[model samples]
Target: MFRFFESLIDPYPGAVPETPPRRLLAFLFHYSRPLLPLLLAMTFFAAMVSVVEVMFFAFMGELVDWLAEAKRERFFADHGGRLLGMAALALVAFPLLVLCKSLVTHQSLFGNYPMRVRWLAHRYLLEQSLPFFQDEFAGRVSQKVMQTALAIRETVVKLMDVFVYVVVYFTGALVLVGRSEPWLMAPLLVWLLGYLVLMRVFVPRLKLISMAQADARAHMTGRIVDSYTNIQTLKLFAHTQAEQAYARGAMDGFMETVHRQMRLVTQLTVSLQTLNSLLLVTMAGFAILSWHQSLISLGAIAVAIGLVMRLRMMSDWILWEVAGLFENLGTLQDGINTIAQAQAVSDSPKAQELSVPQGEIRFDKVTFSYEAGPRGMDDGNHAARQANVFDNLSLTLRPGERVGLVGASGAGKSTLVNLLLRFFDIGDGRILIDGQDIATVTQASLRRHIGMVTQDTSLLHRSIRDNIRYGRPEASEEEIIEAARRAHADTFIRQASDPQGRTGYDAHVGERGVKLSGGQRQRIAIARVLLKDAPILVLDEATSALDSEVEAAIQEQFYALMEGKTVIAIAHRLSTIAMLDRLVVMDQGRIIESGTHQELLELGGTYAGLWQRQSGGFLGLEAAADAAPIGAAEGQTRGEGEASVPDRQRQ
Candidate 1:
């Protein structure tokens, strides 16, 4: 009962697995466990109602025959009182059980199970490793969560309402018809066999169409959401019509499936009607013939007629019920395909909370490769790919050391950071913080000791206060304000007000902070990291969004934030890392040089060449390694500079 009630409002307080449910029946059982008993009890009550209905129809038929009898005077004297008593019993029981069924139907349909399914799906999906979300469409995933729950609810309710009633009512018809005239049983048996055959032929076709429809619907939603997320790109390129056509294509496929499925349904109805008419005519004719021969009474003919007519009504209803069942089942199958996925990274069984005292970071011969295929499994030739990233990389940072990592794109700079965070496990390596291998510590606890500011910031669709406070959710207002001030974000935050009339720190930032400028978003990110105030800090082009003046202004704050902290800063802009304690230069996944800014210049190696190519504070290593300084031409076109060896090289 608790599971059922909980399922209505939220997924039961049990762990949701990260993989697709093993099978549909088992999956439904787990989610619908709480409602099972109630549903069964409801089914029983519905069956009783069907029994009452059959009895009522039988009594009415008998009463009609009794009224039409030639020996009416004799019948009234013999059986009139008992007939009236049975009639009264049927009258009271029919409506009473109907009222009970209605109450149960109301509860089951509106009990909030859909809401719970959505919540559970979202919660479990968010818990999946980052790659999973990256691979799926946000809108499509969202659509499936919604579609699955509704489909399940409709399917369950309809099963009890239509299916349970059909079984009991059909049985009642067979028994009543058999007792009335044994010859009439032949028609019922034939119709039953025909119905089973019809389902076997049509149900599989409906399931296929339903699956197709679900896929097309999800695709359509994903296309629309993709367009919306990139609305600016469409407007800028004037491609709104093209995107619309793309979405229309998906809709066209959906419409086509619906057309085909509806045609099948039309055929099904025609077939069912044919069978129903035959059953009705055959049974009624047989009953009349038997009665004419005096082999059965007129009451038996009337009862046979009632059962055949009842069967006709039920057969018509069953056509739709079966169609709906397959439709919903297909939807659930589709939803499960997208919603359940295996986790690439998960916490170890014995992982413990990290204790960061001095914040020393060590990379112990760390090596990794980009995944060869889905699930990050290496198919073959994985060693070739592995060699391209890091073979036996080793690095260590002392407490309070500030290290700058300079590298060309794909030079393993960001991969180093990824390894530290354990976003993906290493192929063969250990990253330790304060002597604790990061892999040995719980991800949540390891992350607690480190704060990061990435180049592309993604803020939640929330207020400025909440985004800032995200760094330290429990931080007081004063602390939040202080962090914002330190990040040079207080000025803009105070000046801003959203359309909803929320001003200052309370102002809403639209999705991914679309309402704010790139610089503003970067500052908010900085404020978040500052508020975090972790022992270890990572800055990946952290101030790339700021102008030269703003960057200079915040340089003081950045220094202050780095005080007594172990910092790993990645900068395409060479100037940002000049003041760090040491500079590490990497190329082709190996650290080529490690020294102070001045020492690297004196070495006249790869570091010296990159420094000379530095134009407008950026190291342009990708454009032309030998080209004369292009910074003056394009304000830092990728890695172009003429190196007239510096005086520092001689020093």
Candidate 2:
């Protein structure tokens, strides 16, 4: 029972496979079971309405026979008041029955029932892991959810309506016609066989067409969303014409698919119409022959004709309804595929919560590679290349140790930080915090203890105060203001204004904080980190976006903020980490050197060369003269720096 419920919740378990059409119907039934009572009620009403329609037609046949017999007498009297009353009753009862059926159908199918199902499905989708979003486009996912819900609702309601009516009406009409003159039903049976064959032949094609149309629509929507998201990039690169052409091409493909499906539907309708006309003519000829041979009365002929008409109409209606059901089923099937295919990140079944600790971090033989290489790429070809971001690398940081990491671009700086935060699991080794393996801890609880500020600052479209408070949702207004002051953002928040001259921390930041300047956004991000006040802090070129003047002003406050915290700073600019007690210089994902700024300079290796290149020109002639290498002094004279210099100088 438990396993069945689990399967119901996750219909496509294990890597999502292609679900057969029947599986989609099963999923709908499982989810919509809660509304079964309403569904059954609607079905009952629909059956009753159909029966009433057949009875009304039968009554019309009776009325025609009565009029034929009473040529000179009062028509109502000749038939007696009972017949008149029945006709009158049908006039009132049919409408009442239809009204009741419509009421139930609308409430159950269009109102709360489907909406509740959609709400639950949407909630479950939102609970999916980040990898799901990584693998799918946001707009496409949303479109699938919405369109699937609507398709399911529409298809279910239509299937219910058609199923009930066709069964009840066709069964009743067939019985009546067979009793009146059994030969009349022969044609209908043949028609039913032909109809089944037609569906078998064409339904698969319709399903394929529907699936193709859905894919085209999703592709067009994804393209539009991508273009809008990168509108700035498009304009900057002067690719407007190219983007427009791409969008038009996608739209054209979508329209072509839609038109092809429409053509198929048209062909189906024409074929069905011709078949229906032939059946009508054949049945009429049979009725005429039977009447001429005196095998059936005129009244019986009337009844048979009425029954044949009902059967023909019901057959066409049912066929069309079934076609629509299949098309919608195709759409629903695609949506199910999307949701099922969403890649879920591996998670432990019994993950433990992260306990508060003293923030000691250790990386033991950690190695990571973002991509698996091609089969033929040799080890030496790879080995001489830069190592995997972290190849058999190890590090340890005690509680409250402020360490700085210096490395060139592509030297595993950000990768190290990402590992510490457990964004991605280490490939070969364990990352432990206070001796607890990170993989054992709950991801949410583990991240709550760490705070970060990156070079690219991002803020939500919300009030400045709210953005700051996002770091710690329960923080009081006073606490937020204090954090802002520490990050030097309070002054800017006070000066910030929206239109109409309103100014304060309550001012709204535009989407992704685009309304704010880079410096202002950085300060706000820093304020968020301060507000979080986590035990471990990671600054990955955090202040690099700010100008030198702003950086200098914030560094003093940053030092004060760093007290009693475990800090890891990664920077390319050596000057940023010059004041740290210890500096670790990395090359090709391996730490090649570690020491204080002065100690590294004295070693006169990679660090010394980097320092010389940065400070050599800025210090001017006298400073350069004092620092000239032993053999280069005769060639490089002081105060002759500019006069004797060539057009190009290499550092």
Candidate 3:
């Protein structure tokens, strides 16, 4: 039975709106559509429960009058059937209705509703473009996703329950009072008006404060998470005090918002208690005066006082319910800021799967700038935005060609690779793999045909085997080990174990592979990419962390891995790429020189000068010197740097 209720709604709905509504009511209605019928059934049961309680009160008044006016011998004869029927309802039917409401609520809606909401919200977040994540703290974004789900569930379900019960219960009370003496309804009506007035004044103020509180909490969480993620850097720099101070600033902001919210809550409590006291006093006085004037029965006076006392108790509960509703609504609004935005990047409706046979790559006059704003929006900011990373830049690699990229920092080397991967859509022009434009192909398919290894490799906190198999899920165990061996990663992996004693491939890597050395992490990353075996490969300072012996050991394997693939390699250690088929030297986002290493050396251009500046196989340039054009120097004839290459190579 429990499982039956849990399965009533699919937790992961197949279809969802691309953009969620921002307005509270619309947002609630949108997510609630699947649960609406069950929710309405619950509301009906709540209303019936309210009606039963009111009937019980009326029955009590009737019984009081019956005992006073009837003889003891004839009491059962006069009211026996009705009394027995009411007893049965109280014992059986009333409990059943309450049970039905509870089942729909606790057993079904409460759990499934939030889970469904979170699933959809998480899906929407996954669809967001790379820049969206780059712009926000990861921890804060996840917190909003989690908080919004619970807040929406609490706001909708509790508000529904409270609203239905109050309305039905109040209406029944008013009718019971009016039947005794229509004038007796005055106090009840006045009390209700004052209650609404209080809600009107206090609820909006609570909502605003709650929203501020939610934002502050998220900000504080983001700061702490940032510190933790960079804990190694903190420890290395010995800045524990500075880290604490940085986190404290966010903590103080959060406390200020919390203080404001508590102040409003205190004020609201005092005002509500005062109003409830007046209602109880006024209703009791009126009931007694009506009975003295002979305008109402003893039973009517009893019912009036009873109803007023019950309301007095309920008013406090109602106050809290209304306050919590607005507070959750405020939280929902904060969540909406993260979850309701439309996807900045999405596949075109008619996009096709990318197919790469020859692995030919082309950049046809591509132009791009990160400063163009997300979604490539062009506004007044465009005029003041930073210069384009690539402007009318064009490059191509023939099938199975191996080329190296040589440039200083900010020379557009990485940006060019990012554009080819379609991490950001180009501001103009097109990138094609083979003949199909990348923009016209599904992103998943485009990425599947390319494999890349970066200097700053990050691994999932999963088993070594699982991380390697991630490149191809169906790969067998033998294949995984072989790939690791080729990447020369198998030696240390055999010795690897987590604190849990799980050894070798089964052992878990710590967060972001922090348990592993930089070289070990890079080797695992290389192994994974090797398993992927894509037709196109990119290496961006891929071996920067390895010691000379290990680097030399893997150099042959890397050459083999590059066979029959179009490769683009980037390295500060120019020697690693100097032996490739060709070298392309970029400066200020344009390809300034391109040729074989020997040819470029013969040209005595930018590439030759950069080669001349290398020490121990790595670019050794001072900050200011790298900025200036390093073309052939004055008083040095062509091939002057080329003639000295052998001597430096021997060093």
Model 3 weakest lDDT span, ten residues long = 642-651
Candidates 2 and 3 compared: the better one by lDDT is 3
> What is the lDDT, from 0 to 100, of the residue 346 in candidate 3?
71
Assess the local accuracy of residue 454 in candidate 1 as a C-alpha lDDT between 0 and 100: 87
User: For residue 70, what is the lDDT in candidate 3?
Assistant: 87
Model 1: residues >4 Å from true position, as ranges? 1-20, 69-96, 99-105, 108-110, 155-161, 372-388, 625-651
Candidates arranged by lDDT, highest first: 3, 1, 2
Better-scoring candidate (lDDT), 1 or 3 = 3
Poorest 10 consecutive residues by lDDT, candidate 1? 642-651
For each candidate, the alpha-carbon lDDT, in order, equals: 0.79, 0.72, 0.85
Which candidate gets the maximum TM-score versus the true structure?
3
* lDDT (10s digit) by residue, model 2, range 142-174: 878777877787788887777878889878777
* Residue range 495-551, candidate 1, lDDT tens digits: 999999999999999988989989999999999999999999999999999988888
The most accurate candidate by lDDT is 3
Clashes of 1: 3
Question: In lDDT terms, how accurate is model 3?
Answer: 0.85
| Decoy 1 TM-score against native | 0.88
Runs in model 3 deviating more than 4 A are 373-376, 623-651
Instruction: Show pairs that collide, candidate 3.
Output: none
